[model samples]
Each structure stands twice: as structure tokens, then as C-alpha cells.
Target: MNSHKQLFILSCLSLVLVLLSGQFGLQVEAGHHIHHRSKKLFVFGDSYVDTGNTNKSKPGSWKEPYGITSPGKPTGRFSDGRVLTDFIAKYLRLRTPITHRLWDYTVPKHSLKYGMNFAYGGTGVFDTSSSGPNMTAQIDIFNQLVQENVYTLSDITNSIAYVSVAGNDYNYYLATNGSLPGFPSFIASVVNQTTINLIHLQSLGFKRIVVGALQPLGCLPQATAQTSFQSCNSTFNDLVTLHNNLLNRSVTKLNQEINDHNTFTILDIFDGFRTVLNNPSSHNIKERLKPCCFGVSSEYNCGSVDENNVKKYLVCENPESTFFWDELHPTQAGWNAVYNELEKRGLYKILY
Candidate 1:
């Protein structure tokens, strides 16, 4: 027998031995199967958790300097580093889920592996000034894919959905002659509509849905910069608490109404934001009320450009030590702190 032929036979024998041993190759195969069995994450929400699903042609995400920390360039995420979704994915031991718009950009198997992100920035539960799809339309997009068999019924049955309203609807209401005096009614309307959406998602086969409560809007850098970032406007937080209380009760009621053992959950972004904002010093954060990135002048807002097209916004010396990254969102580190709190408080227990 030729030496080459003998080597080939030996290689085949070695492969058989490895398979029978169940030490390396078989273990790898079993591990892969287990990973696939884990819950797939599906995200739907506004700017706070949008991972680049916005229109790229416009100045929306996927532009310069947005993803400077993680992907080293703009990748459509609304943070300098990771966002809430990223932390959630990490907790689940899964990759950052792909955005719905970028679904075609990834491999077909990958698109189905962790589910798709339907969240778009500048959107609300109802219609908004922006032309993008509202919460109902976003769910329609998901349904269209289901009809096309892009995702199987069983795939969705085991999947987890994350929804974030993030106060866009309220902002829209305030912008269009909606006064604070009538805001409670508006809040009730929004939560009622959102409850309908959550039920629809459950009917569509989602195992568990997680929704976020409104954050401390008045404490955001955009609001508190008027006070020189020295203090949070308690009036704003008061409104937020009212909204959150209503939202929590609405979610709890939904969980009770579900016919099956399954339920929709709420992640209290309101308390999560407040916990960080109330004690920024504990997190080594200096300015809890000031955004890390700000316009060169008070008249301007974040993402402002100068005469030479240079960015006029200033990023703080230590982004990790700040809560607000820009006008509305939190920094990656800021979110990490919040996620830690959520984990400590059992908000993410069912998510993974």
C-alpha cells in the first residue's frame, strides 16, 4: 500500500474515533443545539433602543460618529457604545439582534437565529410627525414576514419580544397643543393602545413581551441643561411617576387577563433611570443631569455642526461617568448601570 493511501485511511479512522469519543466534536455539536434552544430576542421600540433601523440616507442613524465605541463607526445604534438591547442580548448570551431593515443584509439562517429588531427611532404607539411606521405598522411588518414564512410559527412561539415607548407619543402630544392638564387622559390613551398592541403580539405567537415604562424625561440633559445640570426638575419627574404608575398597573392587568400561563412584562425604565439619576455619585458619575455630548452654544442641540462642518457638540472627558450621552439617550456605561439594576431587581429574569 502507498504511504499516501495509508495516511488517508488513518485520517478517516481518527475522525471516527473522535466522533465516538464524544469529547470534542460531539460536545461542540451538542452545545450548538443547546444554544439554538435558548429564547430568541425581538426588539420593538423608539430611539433609546434602536440599533440602526432608521433610514440611513437621511441624517438618522448609520451616520458618522454614532457607533464610535463598539463598531468603531456608525452602525445605526443610538449609543456611543452598547444600548439596552445590547446589554439584554449579552445577558441572554446571544449576539446583538439585527435590525429589520438590515435583515436582508445578513444570512438567512442568522436572520432567524435571534429574531429581528422592529424598533425605529422617532416613532410612537400612534402616528407621529415623522413618516416612519408607528407601533402598529411595525408589528404589521413583522406579520408580513410571518406570512412570507421568513419566521416559522414555532420560532416565534419560543421568542421574547422587547418593546420601548420611551415617551415619543407624549412628546408628539406636547408638540401639537396637547396641554399638561389633559396629559393624564393622553397617558391613559397611550397605555390602552399599547396594551392592545401587546395582546396582538401574544396572539401572533410571541412567548413573553417586555415593555419599558417612561423614563425621567425632565431629568434628561435636554431638560435640565437650563438649570446648568445642577438639579433635576421635580415637576418633570412627578409627571413621569404618574405615567409609570399607570403603565405598571396596565401591564399587571394585561398579565392577569392572558388566558394562558404566559404574560406580558414591563421593565421599569422610569425607576431604572431614576435610580441612576438619584445617585449618580455612587456610579462615579459627576454630572447626572448633563449630557456628555452637547452643542457648543446653548441655543443649539446635540449633533450640531460648525462652520467648517466640524462637530460643535462636546463629549465629556469620561463618558463612563455620565448618564446622558446626548439630548435623549443614555451612554453605554449608563445603560450598563441600569441593566445591572434591572438584573438585581429581577426585571430581566424572564427575558433570558
Candidate 2:
């Protein structure tokens, strides 16, 4: 071969190698987005991300099918596998935090290393039908630990807080004779209290505080199965809109108050969820509103079992295709999608 032709072929091979390396670099960067942050995650609120924080003796979450996808048995989390907090921690390069309920008996040394998870499943900003501690009480526990020096001011200053209030308070309202006429007043009260909680977390010195906006409750499997899961009930989503607006305004005002630090951010789970639901195929999801697991009837749930160790809830043929893990929560993959959307939109940028 001529010398010029040999050099040309070598140059072409070099170009192809560069392209392949560039593609690999992009994947590494995407993966780092979830695992490179310095701030540790401290989760709060309902089953959307609860990691065994509920009482186990009551058949709450430590039962069959709860952790089937991850641990192959039930853990305290309210999903078939890892929940939202797990993915958030994975993004931050930290371990999935220990639940406060279980930490009392387990390893106490590592409790303060990665921060503590004060979230309780089935709880809300206010007292709900479920008998878990409300958000106010949960914050109190976080505060008590700080006072006891279990978590120092420096630890809190370096840590990030993730608070998720996923409509348990609203459900409580409807369960207790709450009517449409009184919903606005009730919602206002709920958001008002939630704002206080966020502000209080900032006052306690968390570098970044993320409060998740309400998800599309009306589109949950329990609600949609009534309509054959063909479409979402717009009325329920309208209520969600009102809640999100109030939350956005409250977070905005709070951020203004902390202008120097810029310590507060809204996670906007509402819009992130809506984006996936509206464009499921783009996200590799086929069933946006349908749950991966559901009760055989309205009377049962994801963990309910038959006499022969058989699951009562009907699981979807493919969980990765669906956004919801059950009637009320998102699957691990579903939450990964939400977390990515939140990060892509600059929601995780923590200043000061």
C-alpha cells in the first residue's frame, strides 16, 4: 500500500475510537448525575418512598411481595422493590438511609454517618386515617436528635432534606366528610402547614431542602380501575393543580426569605409524573397510570396473600412498562424516571 493511503486508514480508525469513547463518557456522566452529589438525603413522608419505617408487626410493609423485585422478599418499603429515597440516595452516592423506626434496635454508629430517614409511610402533614406520625411530629424527631447531638449542626448543614406529602391528608379529609365546598379551605390549611415545615427545616440549617409537590392522585390505579384504567379523571387532577399552585407559591416565598442562601427547592413530582404519563413511549413506559401490582378487588392490596402463600394483588405482566408500583406508589424504575426529570430541570442545584 502507498504510504499516504496507510496513514489515511490509521486516521479513520482513530476517529472511530474517539467516537466510541465519547459515547461511553456520556453514559458515565448520566450515571454520575444520580451518584455524585455531596449532600446526603434525609427522607420524609408517605409510602411513595418509605423504607420500612412503618411498624412491622401489623402486616404493614414487612410482608410478601413488598420487596420481591429487589430483595426477593418483603422489606418495610411500600413497593415491590426500592422506592424513591433509594434512587435519590443512589444519585447522591449514599446508601439508602435507615428508617427511624428500625434504627432503635439496629446499628447506631452508622445512623449519623449518612443522616437518618424520618419519613413514615401512610402519614401526612396532618393526622390521617393511618396512625403514623404526622410531618410535624417527624420534624420534631429530627429536631430532638439534633438537640441530643446525635446529629450536629455541621451534619445538618451538609445534609439535604427530602419531604414528600403524597395526598394522605386529602384522603383523610375525604374520609371524614370533607366535601368539595370545604376542600379549598382544607387544602389551603394543608399547604400552609407544609410551608411551615419546609421553612423550619431551613431554619434548622439543612443546605438544601426539597419538598415534593403532590402527584396525580386521581390517576392512581385505585382511582383509574373504576374507569377501566383507560383514562385519568380530570376532576381529581384539577384538585392536584390547586395543591401544586399553592405549594409553588409557598416555596417561592420561602426561597425569597432565604435569598442569601437559596436553600429551598421544589421537587415538582407533579409535573415530572405528568411528563412520563403524557409521553410514556418516549420514556419506555407503556402503561403510565396502571399499577404493576394491584389487589384482586378493592378490599385487598399489594401485600395481601391467600391461604397458599399466593399473592392476592394482580401484578402487571411487566413492571418496567408501568409507572405505578401499586395503587398508591411508583415502582423503583418509575421513581428513577421522576428523579431524572427533576435533575434535568435543575431542581437538585443546591446553593450555599
Candidate 3:
């Protein structure tokens, strides 16, 4: 009787094992589907979205104290850590795409499966002071890769393009002695060029393309530094609003022209920055204007060092508590907060 009971128990255990295996298989399949549907991310634009594609010898992003928050070292990101592109890729459940400049030597060609970043710091849609690849040049590189069959047609169709022009063009204009009274016309010209760039991307067969609206230039540390970081210059912000309005109309027109509402989206980065800055407590930021790092005086800037290799810039005690990282860029924490706000505003569903 004991031997018979033992045989019956063994048979029951085998049946339970089969049931557990079936359940595990379902979980695995679900995860696989999510990953496959996530698709790829292709990034473009200036310092706001650049992920280390600039010249290594450049003094800004690749210098010391630039990436002290996360990596604990500089990695060509203008912030203390990852920038907007990294966070956007994270939202899409994809790897932060590799820097386009690092492809042949440092990065393996097989890594192209995630997509590539063609953004260069300090670049604009038109030429800028940074003397880097403009938006058109960046697109040319992407086109070359496509022609070489580096990315399959399936990859192109499934991927989303992220374009972040920010305010570099306006900065270039102001610095180049462009007349202020004629600024509105200049703003129109900038928007027109940007629209052309968007159409060019669409012509390349991108099913979905998201571009960032110009953020509030008044709130940047560079502008607020005059007020000892106490107040923003509303004049700059008004100009920013003009740029954003024109950009919104342009994007809407593009979608209507293409007959696909989902084809082009204007990611309201301006709103994202304003919302996060206005509600610091909501995002755990102590203040929004003061930068996390800066040089000792006006003669120098973030990442500045003395002749003897001594650091000239001062970094905040805790970068996670700050918003802006330097005169122009946001810290990793700041970008995270902006990403959260954008997500709350439906960036996910709009993109995917």
C-alpha cells in the first residue's frame, strides 16, 4: 500500500511541473513582444540632444566636471550626466543610441541596431559659432548610412526621429550682430528653415518624427547670471514664445500636408521646462535658475581649468538638487524631471 501511494504522488508532481512551464512560456513571450514593439530611436539637433558626437578635443562637453553626477566622469554630455536624448530612449525602452562619430573606431558596427545619434553640440539648423555639423549635414550622414544599407528598410520604418533644435539659431543670430528690431523676421526665417528640415526628414521615410520647441531662453543661467540668478529676463522668454508659436504652426501644417497626424509631433519642451521650473518641489529641485557648475569669474565657464591643470569651475555639493548644469544645459536630474513632465503630458502615447 505504501509503494502504491508513492507512485501516485510522483505522477501528480510531474503534471504540476508541466503547468508551471506553460505559464513561464507565456511571460517570456509577452516580454519579447514589448521589446520588439519598442522600435528604434534616431536623434538629431544641438547640445540639448547631443550624446558625445562632437569633437573629442572640444573644450566643453568632453572636459572635466561635465558628467560628475552619474558616470562620475566626463563623457561628452553637456550635463552632469545623461541629456534629453538618453531619457527619451529610456522611455522608448531602447538603448541610448551610439554617437555617430564613434562608429568606425571605438564603437562596433553591429551596435547600429539601436540607431545612431547625429547631434553635435553648439550646432543649429543653419550655421552657428560652434563650427560643427549643422542639421543639414547631420541628415546627410544619416542618408549616407541608409544608402550603404547600414540600416534596413524595416529599421527606418519602425524607428522614431528626435530633433531638438533648441535656441542655438537665435543665439547665433544675436551674437552675429543681427538687428533686434528685425528679430521677428529673423525668427520667421529660422522657423522656415526648420520646417524645411522637418520636410526633409519626412522625405527620408520616417513614419514618426518628434521635434523639441525652443525652451525659455530667459531662464537659462547665462541670461539670469546678470541678475545674480535671482530673476529671468522676460524679453528673451518673449522671443522664445514667438519661436515656439511659429514652430507649432509649422509642425501642424506639416502633419496636415502629409495627411498623417501621427507623422509629426512637436514635443513642447518649452512647456516641459517651464512646468518643472515653476514647480521645483514637485520635481525635487531646490531651484531652477542657478547652475550646478561655473567658473570662478566671467572670463571662464564650466569645465574651465587653469594653466597648471587645476580646476577653475566650482561644482555644487549635490547635482541632483539642481536643475541647470551650466550656462545652457540641464543636469541629469533636471533632464529627468523634464522627461517626467513630458511623459505626464502624454509624450509616450504621442510618440509610440
Output the number of the lDDT-best candidate. 3
Note the residue pairs that clash in candidate 1: 52-76
TM-score per candidate? 0.85, 0.85, 0.89
lDDT (tens digit, per residue) of candidate 1 on 40-156: 888887888788788886563565556666677777777777898888888766788888888757566755687788888889999987666889999999999899998888878
Which model, 1 or 2, shows the larger lDDT?
A: 2
lDDT of 1: 0.78
lDDT ranking, high to low = 3, 2, 1
Best by TM-score: 3
The weakest ten consecutive residues by lDDT in model 1 span 25-34
What are the lDDT figures for the candidates, one per model?
0.78, 0.79, 0.87
Query: Model 2, residue 307: what's the lDDT?
Result: 86
Q: Return model 3's CA RMSD, one decimal.
A: 7.3
Record all residue pairs in model 2 with backbone atoms less than 3 Å apart, i.e. clashing.
34-91, 35-91, 52-76
